[model samples]
Target: MPLLRLIMLALAYLLPLCVWADSIVMVAPRETALTRNFVEALSSRLPTDTFEVRLLSSTPAPDSASLLITLGQEALHWRLRQPIVTPTIATYVTLDGLQQLHDEVRPASVQILLASAKPERQIILAQLLIPRLDTIGLMFSEQQRWQTRFWQAAAIQRGVNLYSRGIPGQDQLPRVLTNVLNQSEVLIGLDDPALYNAENLKTLLLTSYARNRVLIGPSAPFIAAGSLSTTYSSPENMADSVIDMLQETWRPAAIRYPDRFSVLSNQQVARSLGLPPPDDAELMRRIHAQEQSR
Candidate 1:
């Protein structure tokens, strides 16, 4: 049956294509440079032949989509309010931001890619930058106090002490920061906008600089504004991370930080503190080696 064999071969090829073909819908709160860059980066990398990616403009997401991706917190909130049942991957949200919405009813299947790096990674970076770094300072808002335990555990494992202060309100920041800096060699900025916003970051940097202690762990933008160093993921890095997750046969619903990142340093700040820190490339290599060893 030559005809039957031809039909079977055609079906075999078509079946795999049908099974692999996935439609991905990306939704963002609004059109912005950040969203545009991410979309462009993702589009360039995703295999056009197998994946169909579209930007969602309105609600009632297409039912044919194999997956939905929300670009930011606002988009994610909007999607959560809807009744769509497609599995979603929410990006550009910090751990605390996502936690704030955890109590709200959401879709059954959702995952998050955190905007911040792991606390352990931050601690390790600090340790690498500051030799014999024993005591590390952390100032967190009341909403982020629960995260201190994770930071403390990471510090303890590395034989370093974490001196953390919780700020009940913005008014208490000056006092809390003073106390934390007095006890610790360096301050590690947590990923809380309430504590680390533009209005507050300048003061934090000035205060830490006055104390001759460097600040670490804020994102790349802060590095330009006097933060000593940080590990950050760019749009391309995030797109690659999403690609990795998509390729996985089974991606469980979990909150994860980007596995790939680039290290940045403020040579001026390092010089001002009289600290000779490794260059960005070396620091990244060391961090990678440490992660691999773990």
Candidate 2:
């Protein structure tokens, strides 16, 4: 909640008479540590071709920026229908802003995927795994214990083992990972700092392979390391896309799901794990497709 009263420090760079650049104001409901960090990142990293940015302090009046990015649900509610702006949007994921400007309707599964970030990666992995395989195992344990949700009636209806270490964190992670690999075929890398922080990927995954197990998670960085496969996304891809939509015109108010998680695997990784390595042509095509979509 530290960024709540943030004033537009960068707006001064934007000049009047609609200067050569488009000025954009970013609004978030509260002054969160994460929000402040993002503002810093955006100011330095946002594409210069189309934008200049301002920070709005929850004041209702619209100021400069050609487009305003409202972060989080609170901002979404207040800004979208402001007697001034129309249907901005509500992006619950990234927990970034609540602009009434979102106009894309995404699948429920995709929404869950978007909402699942570094901390709650396990939850997202559970959603994807519980529906596809039984006896899914947590390589390490921490914030989200899968048993709670997976044990529910709906989950029971689906039927799968929601296994865990019972004892989680740095001390027990390696053995726990070993145990989970023994108990199940597929492993979920939940991004718990205690387990994933300093562990090198090649060794951890090779250990799973020795036990004849597979691994999957949301980081593109992992796939290259030796895990059987992984799903990938970058903040910049989504951020730039949203900025472009807001600048051009008004559309539907909805969540735009990431197209698909990138799948990464090598012949050795795939073969030993029982997955046929995806055609290199297909992989290249998919990567190209993502570039074109952007």
Candidate 3:
């Protein structure tokens, strides 16, 4: 009888241990290089027993997962369509995309690791690059008015002026660009393609140079195309954000930009503007120090 009782107690203990091993479901829409890199970085940070990656189309997740980490917007869309009660953490999604989803879903446990850097981060980096900077210009479509307002408020709090314009259509680009660049020392680009499409980016960069205005943007390509600098997060930084999210209690569904960032600068562009360019290492250190001081 004592042997029977011992066997039942052992079964009860092992059951929860087995269940805990399969508590996480990591989903990605496709098997692309970016997805692979994110998964690799994330795996290195999280323990093997903590989570498992699965292809969104092929794998059926367990009935209940403690956490659902979606790699991109498509995976997030797929997961939201299902009857999932588990908390979701989305990576590589833009703030605009995440906000649209939030408006539609009004989900409680959904969170995002936004692709773009926060406005404060951009403002600080721009100030570092151009110490005399007082006014920053931004061009966005009417759909992004909310974002513009958010940036404007953030800039005002830091004692900087935000000269932002809402373009109604592509036809107003030249006129609006000329007007804003005239008053602003730096032009910061958002993730909006309406303002920075392939056809318009060259002209925009050229216009900023003509006005002696430094252009700080979100993508590395902007630096390659003669912008002074860009602020973006790396895959490793994203892994750290995810780890932080998992350790906390779920919050309201919202887009959260990365706390850590990498800044890229074009030395040739800086030289052409007669501005001294700081080395990447020194620039990063200064930014980190400023962030810590704040």
The CA lDDT of each predicted structure is 0.78, 0.47, 0.77
Candidate with more favorable, higher lDDT: 1 or 2: 1
Instruction: Please provide TM-scores, in order, for all candidate models, with all chains considered together.
Output: 0.87, 0.49, 0.87
List residue ranges in candidate 1 displaced over 4 A: 1-21, 49-60, 106-108
List the candidate 3 regions with Cα displacement exceeding 4 Å. Answer: 1-22
Please provide, for model 1 over 129-175, each residue's C-alpha lDDT reduced to its tens digit, 9 standing for 90 to 100: 98789999999998888778888888887889888889998888899
lDDT of 2 by residue, 33-143 (tens): 656655555555455654433344535535444455555555655554454421233333432221122463322111111332332223333334224566766644444
Per-residue alpha-carbon lDDT of model 3 for 1-294, expressed as tens digits?
366544543343334322332466789988998878888888887678877888878866665566678888888888778775556687888866765674457466577788876787788888888887789999898877768877887798667999998899889998999999997989999878667778998889889899888888757678887788877878887887777765554565766887767888899999999989757767777877877797
lDDT of residue 167 for candidate 3: 90
Pairs that collide, model 1: none
Colliding residue pairs in candidate 3: none
Candidates sorted on TM-score, descending: 3, 1, 2
In angstroms, the error of model 2 at 76 is 14
